[model samples]
Target: MQKEVLIHVRGLQMMDAQGDQEPIEIIVPGQYYFRNGSHYLRYEELLDETAEPTINYIKVSGTGLEVSKKGLVNVHMVFEQGKKNMTYYTTPYGTLQMGISATNLELTESEENLQIKADYALDMNEEHVADCYLAIQVQPRDCKDFVL
Candidate 1:
């Protein structure tokens, strides 16, 4: 089963001598959960090495619900885009410790109408680790739009 997610993005521009690039700060309310029989608990999901990843990122996008709608969805995350082998996050858990390095985040149109799929990978350092991937997909609503 799949669900919709509400993601909040703040506009930000990073400037350097080369040029100025504006990226949005994404605030996503996580909603993915795992059940351990008696109780349904918040759980973390990771990506196996089968998916190839070049750069590290923190990505979030749509489910099987949004397809072929440009600007209707967003696959947002943070990482050094140009640099190769640059790690986006590494064990930066302040109170709780875990690094979910998302990469290859892609959202594309499928053959089916209004149905989209998002794919990405999580860089997990250990075989058995804490579940830190907090992802929540939600219903769509009208939000204020901003431009760079």
Candidate 2:
């Protein structure tokens, strides 16, 4: 796929069991860049032969670009499952963080000549996060590869 089509997502999830709330799942869509500043991302549905509870879609649009993503999101598949972790990314309620198992990430935009690299960890912290890291690079798709 091209480098200008991506919708990144990261946040916490809550589940209700026995009339109580608990942290049973997480959504870590990795980090991305558009270079154009802001963009849009939207998703309606998706399919994954493996993961049963596959993610429907992920959309993002800001000031520069737009994109849609679909697939299964397993924190355990991407994270190391930390110790009773509780994280947040939206609203004015609580903090947001997640357990990640990303070994290494490298994204290089051959067009824009940009790149980024990141590491993985069992635990992370996001006391006050908003998760507004969606950028866009519209049309003609002109950019380079980037590393996570």
Candidate 3:
């Protein structure tokens, strides 16, 4: 892949108590690079007209993946197969203790694209909130297979 890329992200949150929720999907332009044996993807997300855009960073390593966001909300989350990670999530509304217990983590990469899928359970304030699935696809901006 090239430095300029298109990222397609799909996220599903299935509430343990309430059942399924709508999946969130987004396709955006992003920057991709490799450093220190890790692949990094960076993008900006505009939450609304008034607030500044949020910066998102994803780091993919051999062992796991880490996602960090800064702006209106700040968070640093880690995902590793069979491991539970905890962090404080700060948002405009308030802060909460968040936990991510990843059940599965898969990655597929080729000359043209990179794909990641993660299945995990999410917890907030020590209570089970939901089971989540996240899929991320990254490809060169000029790739012919790119789609919305």
Give me the runs in candidate 1 sitting further than 4 Å from their true place: 1-94, 108-148
Index of the highest-lDDT prediction: 3
Question: What shift in Å separates residue 39 of candidate 2 from its native position after superposition?
Answer: 8.8
Candidate structures ordered by TM-score, highest first: 3, 2, 1
Lowest lDDT sum, 10 consecutive residues, model 1, at 63-72
Q: What are the RMSD figures for all models against the true structure?
A: 16.2, 12.7, 1.3
- Top TM-score hit: 3
Q: What is the lDDT of residue 22 in candidate 2?
A: 26
User: What is the overall TM-score of model 3 with all chains considered together?
Assistant: 0.96
lDDT of 2 by residue, 1-148 (tens): 3434433233222222333322222222233334344222232223335444343322222211112223343222221112232333221244335543434443344443333223333334733222112122222223243223
Residue 130 of model 3 has an lDDT of 93
Clashing pairs in 1: 4-137, 4-138, 5-137, 5-138, 31-135, 31-136
- In order, what lDDT does every prediction score? 0.26, 0.30, 0.92
TM-score of each: 0.20, 0.24, 0.96
